[model samples]
Target: MALTNPAFSTNPAFKENGQAQTAATLSAENLQQMYEAPSATSVQTDRMTVEDTIVKTAICFAFLLAGAVVGWIVPALALPAALVGFVLALVNIFKKKPSAPLILAYSAVQGVFVGGISFVFEAQWQSIVIQAVIGTLAVVGVTLALFASGKIRASKKATKIFLIAMFGYLAYSLVNVILMWTGVTGGTFGLSSDVRIFGIPLGVVIGIVVVLLGAYSLVLDFDAIKQGVANRAPRIYGWSGAFGIMVTVIWLYLEILRLLAIARD
Candidate 1:
């Protein structure tokens, strides 16, 4: 039961052989200690677990929050941070093994980018950052609740559609960016603002759709983590789960932020 998310799919740690690999490296003394131990936790056994993954995710977010505070104070670092974040994200995603330091670096860099952008948005629209935060939290909370209740799930058919939509959205976004850079479109959001569908700004509609995609991405992240746990992946692989969730949540937040900005305009 492999997941679609590149973070999990490309990593061999989520495979059934993950635990065997860990065991192979253990010394006789370590095995004896484990056998003599009254009870061993997931950490003691060096196996992936949901609780450990949650803790790792929290630690990553904490670093992100700290970096965001710095970015909020100095928004000029936004562009550089974004560039660094993108590179780090690519590195973390394709790396054969999960690296906590690299993942944390990516999260921190992305936080700076997020904070810098939020500050810029807030300058034009008062309190927009807080509104975006609330909206993001609401969406995440509801999505998590539904997923926990088994009301929502990731399926092959839905994931295939998601990938298709992702490609289309990327293409549209690239075109929009080029138009804005070349001065072909005018406004803060380029085509999203200049174009209108049924008297509604094109950005507003696209934002809603993209937000849904982001939400689905979250579902995929959650499913991937669940698979990793079930597979008894190495404890270190928990960082991969955290990284995946962070990526999706940041994406979701940005989409919601842009959507709100377009609506306000």
Candidate 2:
């Protein structure tokens, strides 16, 4: 959000675990006097720390869950909640300083949108929401685990591939929506049910691709947080990092649910 985290800006090796890359003048030892430490300017940043990002992300999700629950129960409040959430997202992205209250408010509204949509989707899909929730958790958990274990890391080539896949999926969705709107088919699915690539359902194909995109998005989000912490950005900006991650996760969950439903129907 800050045109990439400061760690990325300052350090070439920002992607790896986001640990501080710059050499510290004073080690955690008695070799150097604490009082005569060099100025902050002398300290260079290399990457954002993971611990702080986790803490901030946890706080942000709490707010998101609260908002989602409210929105789920109050049908009439859904649209307004989405509007409010959008505004807050923009504010968080643009504001130089993060406000905890504002970020929490955003979470509330986003939660409402999630809940309301979940309610509608569940009504049609029947227990599909649970499946989606579980799937979402699985993906996030797996991704995080792999990342922590150094099994998966973001790369420029992979990122370019992700973007290409995303564009292809979006185009397919647009065409499908158009076909459905024109009453070309009177069924639950559009191109999803009819189209097949290599004997697999088109929807399934697209879903997998999109899910991958969402997963990669998490990588980027984590990278940003890692960068932020490395740069020792204002603690408040931690909220910004949290919000970004939350948004990506939610999107990922929704997409997973939708894909699963497509499979079921």
Off by over 4 Å in 2: 1-49
Task: Provide the lDDT at 87 for model 1.
Answer: 95
lDDT of 1 by residue, 150-237 (tens): 9999988888898999999999999999999999998889999999999999999999999899888889888888887777788888
Worst 10 residues of 2 by lDDT: 39-48
| Candidate number of the best TM-score | 1
TM-score per prediction, in order, is 0.88, 0.77
Model 2: per-residue Cα lDDT over 1-265, one tens digit each: 3236432355433334546544365465643564567734312432234555567688878877887787778756878777888898888766655677887778777888888888878888899988999999988998888877878877778878877887887887788889999988555778886777888767887788789889888887776776567665645566667777788898898798778877887
User: Per-model C-alpha lDDT, please?
Assistant: 0.88, 0.74
Model 2 alpha-carbon miss at residue 28, Å: 13
What TM-score number comes out for model 2?
Answer: 0.77
